[model samples]
Target chain A: MSKVVKIFHGPQHPGITGNMSVELDLIGETIVKARTHVGYLHRAFEKLVERRTAMQAFTIVCRICVPEPDPNEENFARAIEEITGLEVPERAKWIRVLVLELSRLAAYHLWMGGQAGSTGLYTVPQWSVGYRDYILDLFEELTGGRVYHMYIIPGGVRRDLPDGFLDRVSDVMDLIESKLPEFDRLFFDNAVFKKRAIGTAVIDPETAIERGVVGPPLRACGIASDVRRDDPYEIYDKLDFDVITEKGGDVYARALVRRREMEQSIKIIRQIIKYIPDGPYRTKIPYPMNWKLKAGETYVKTESARGEFGYYMVTDGSEYIRRMNVRGPAYVHGVSLLEDMLEGAQLADVAMIMNSLGTCPPEIER
Target chain B: MCTDNPGVWEYIANWARKHSIWVLAYGTGCGAIEMPPTMTSRYDAERFGLRGAATPRQADLLIISGYLATKTLKRVIRTYEQMYDPKYVLALGSCTINGGMYWDSYNTIKKLDLYIPVDVYVAGCMPRPEAIIEGIIALQKRIEEGRAEGAKKYRENIEWYKKNQREVFGDEMLPDYTWNFEGGI
Candidate 1:
C-alpha cells in the first residue's frame, strides 16, 4: 500500500492567487489527485444584486472580480442599457474603452509580478507592483477611488474625465513603455523563468477550447480568440490593436501573450488619448433610486484582463432587480481547468501553474 | 547575568514584538488586492516591520483583508488558533467592521470581532494602502504599549469566541489545533 497525504494549498498560502485552496493528494512530491475548493471569498453577489435596484446593483457587481473590476461594471451597464434601450453618448464609449484598457494594463502589471513571484523572483514583484501604483494614482484622480471605482453605471460613467486626465494617462503609458526593457530583463526574458515555465502544466489546445478557456490562456494555445476582436464592444472596432497569441499553452506562453497584449493595450490607450472627442460624458436617467427597468433578460460580455466577463440580467419591470447572474472566466479557470491541470504535476509547480491560468477566487466564489 | 527584573524583560519583548511583525499573507477577501501595494515598494509596509509570513505558525499579524464568509471564517479561526501567542488581527475594510457593503448578504458575517478578536480596523469599502499603513502603524503602537493583547484575550474567552464561531460553522467546525492548553494561548 502507498502512503498518500492530502495537503491544502491555500485559503492562506502566499502562493495562492486568492482566498481559495487546492486539495492535493500526494504520494511523496507528486500529486495523485487535485481538488479545487472555493467559497472562501463568496459574498453572495448575485443574491445581493437581485435585492438592489439597477443603480444600486452596479456598485456590488464590480466587487465580483476584485482584480479586474471595471469589466463587471461595464457588463452591468451595457446589459441594463441594452434592456432599457438607452443610447450611450459617443464620447462615453471612448472613455469606457480607455478605462477598460487602463484596467487591463494595471491587472497585467500585477499578474507579471505574480507570475514572477511564483517562480521565486522577488525583484519582479517589487518592480511591477511599484510601477502599478502609477496606474492606481491615475485611477484615484479620475474615478475618486483607486480599487473599486464605482464610476461605470447604468446610464454612463458617474462623471466626465477630470482636467488633464488624458495627459496624465499618456505620461503613465510612456513611463510603463520606458520600463518594458527592464521588465524583460528581470522577468519575461529571464532564463530561469523560461526554464521553470516552458513545459510545466502544458494544456492541449483542443482540451483548452472544450474546457471553455478564454483570454490569454486560450490565445496562448495558438487559438486567437478574443471577445474584443470577435464580438466588438465599446469602441473596440474603431481602435487599432492586435489580438496577441502564442504557440504553447504553458505558463511561459501565457505570460508571453499577456506581455504582448500589454503593448496592444498601451497602443489602444495612446489612440484614445490622441483621438478622444469632447462631448457630454453621460445621458441623464430619471431618479435612479426609483428608476424601474422594463421586463427583459439580456447578457453582456466584456474582455477583462483575465478573460470574458459576462453578466446576465433579468428585470421584471420592477425597481428592484429580479435576478442577475455573473459569468466570470474564473469559473472555468479557477475550478475545472485548475483541477484538470494540477493532477500529476510536481508540488513545487502548483502555484506557478495556478498563476499561469490567472484564476481569481472572488469571481469563482461570487 | 540572569539577574533581571521581569518588568524589564517584558518591556524588551514588547518592543521586539512591536517591530518585525510578520503578517499572514492570506488574502481573506477583496481587500487582499490592496496588500500587494502596501507590502511592496510603494507603501513599503516592511519599513515598519510588517512583512508577509507563509504560514500561520510563523505569523504574528493576521490581516483579514475583507468580508469573511462563513466558510473562510472556519479556516481563519483555525489559522488564528494555530498562531503563537501575541498574535494581532487587523480587520480591513468596512465589511468586517459591520458588513459595510454586504450588510444583507446571507453568507458574510456581520461583525468579524464576534468570531475573532480584532486589534485594528481599517475602514473603507476597500481601504487604500495609506489607510492600511495607518492601521499597521496603529497596531505597532498598541503592541509597543502592551495594549494589543488580543491573543491573551482570545485565550481568556476561548469559549465565547468558539461559541460564535460554531454558530456560523455549525457541526462542520474545525478540529481543535490548540498548541498550549495548560497555560498558554
Candidate 2:
C-alpha cells in the first residue's frame, strides 16, 4: 500500500519563482499529484486599468509582472497606439527596440540566477544578479527609475535618449557579453547543473504547441516560435536576429535556448545603437488626463522574458476602458502545465522545472 | 542580573540583532523585484548584515514588499505568527502606506499598518536599492535604540490586530495556533 503525504510548496518559499504555492501529494520523494494555487500576488490590475484613462493605465501595466515589466508596458502602449492609429516616430521605434532588448537581457540575467540557484549553484545568483545592476544603471540613466521605467508611453517612448546613453548601453552590453563565458563555466557548463537539468521535465513539440506554450520554452522544442520573428511588431522586422531553437524539450534545452537568446538580445541592442536614426522620441498626444481613444478593442502580444505576454483591451470612446484582460504566459506554465509536469516527478526537481518553465506568479494572478 | 536596565547581555543581544537582520526570502508583490539588486552585488545589502532567511521561523524581519490582497493578508498573518519573537516588519512602497496606486482596486488593501505593525515604511512606487538600504539602516538604528518592538506590539495587541484581520478576512480567518499554543509550535 502506498501512502500519500500532502505538502504545500510555496506562497513564501525561497524555491518558488514568485508569490505562489503548489500543493503536492508525495509518496516518499516522488510527487504523486500536484495542484497549483494562486491569488497570493493579486492586485486586480485589469479592473484598476479600466477605471483609469488611457495614459494612466499605461503607467501601471508594467506592474503586472515584476522581473520583466517592459513587455506589459509595450503591450499596453502598442494596444492603445493600435486602437488610436497613432504614428510612432521612426527613431522612437528603434529606441523602443533598444529598451525591449535591454529589458530582455536584464530578465535573462535574473533568470540565469534563479535557474542556477534552484539547482544549488549559489554562486551564480551572486554573480548574475550583481552584474544585472549595470543594465539597471542604464535604465536609470534613460528612464530615471531602475526597476519600473514608465518610459514606453502610448505614442512612442516618453523621452529621447539622454546624451551618450547609447554609449553606456553599448558598454553594459559588452560587459554582460564578456561575463557569459565565466557564467557558462559556473552554470551552463558545470557538471552538476548538466546532470540535474538534462532530460528532466521534457516537453515535446506537439504537447508544447497544444498547451499554448510560447517564448523560449516553445523554442526549446525546436519549434523556433518567437513572437519577435513571427509577428514582427515595432522595429523587430528591421532588426537582424535569429530565432534560436533547440531539439530537446527538457530543462537543459530551455536553459540553452535562453543562453543563445541572450546573445541574440545583445546583437539586437548593438544593431539598434548602430542604426537608430535621429528624430522625435514621441508624438504629441492629447492631454493625458482627458485623453480618450475611439471605441475599439485590440489584442497585442510581446516576446517577454517569458513566452508570450498579451493584453486584450477595449475602449468605449471615453477616458475609461470597457475591458482589459491580460494573457500572461505564467497562467498556463505556472498553473495547469506545472501540475501536469509535476506528476511522478522527484520533489527535488520541482523548483528546477519551475525555473526552466519560467513560471512567474504575478503574471498568473494578475 | 538587573531586570530594568544596564545589562551587558541585553546590550550585546540588541547590538547583535541590530547588525544582523535576516529577511525572509518571500516576495509578496511587485516591490519584490528590487530585492535581488538590494541583496546582490551593486547595492550589496549583505555588507550591512542583511540577507535572506528561507523560512519565517528563521527570519528576523518580514518586508511587506507591496500592496496585499486580503487573501494574502491571511497568509502573511500566519507567517508572522510562525516567526520567533524579536521580529520586525518593513513595509515597502506607497501601496503599503496609503495604497499608492491601487487605492481604488477592490482586491488590494490600502493601509498595511492596519493589519500588521510596521517598523519602517520605505515610500516609493518602487523604491530604489539605495532607498531600501536606507530603510534597513533606519531599522538597524531602531533595533539598536531598542525601539523596534513590532513583534512585542503584535503579541500584546494580538486581539486588536486579529479584529482588523478578521474584518478584512471575514469568515476566512486563519487558525489561532499562535495564540492557543496547545500542541506547541
- The numbered model that scores best in DockQ is 1
All models: lDDT?
A: 0.89, 0.89
User: What digit string (tens of lDDT, one per residue) describes model 1 on residues A176-251?
Assistant: 9999989988898999998999988888899988999998999999998999999999889998899998998889
DockQ for all candidate structures vs. native: 0.88, 0.85
Model 2 chain B, poorest ten-residue lDDT window? B1-10
Report the C-alpha lDDT of model 2 over A1-366, residue by residue, as the tens digit. 489899999988999898889999999999999999999888888888878888888888888889988888899889998988999999888888889889999999999999998999989988999888889889988999888899999898988888998888888988999999998888999999999988899999999999999988999999978889889899899889999999899999999999999999999998988888997989999888888788998899999988888888888899888999999998899888999999988999999999999999888888
Pairs that collide in candidate 2 are none
State the TM-score, rounded to 2 decimals, of chain A in model 2: 0.99
In model 1, which runs have C-alpha deviations exceeding 4 angstroms?
A: B1-6, B177-180
Give per-residue lDDT, candidate 2, residue B53.
98
Distance from true location, Cα of A310 in model 2, Å: 1.3
TM-score of each: 0.97, 0.97
- Alpha carbon lDDT at A15, candidate 2: 93
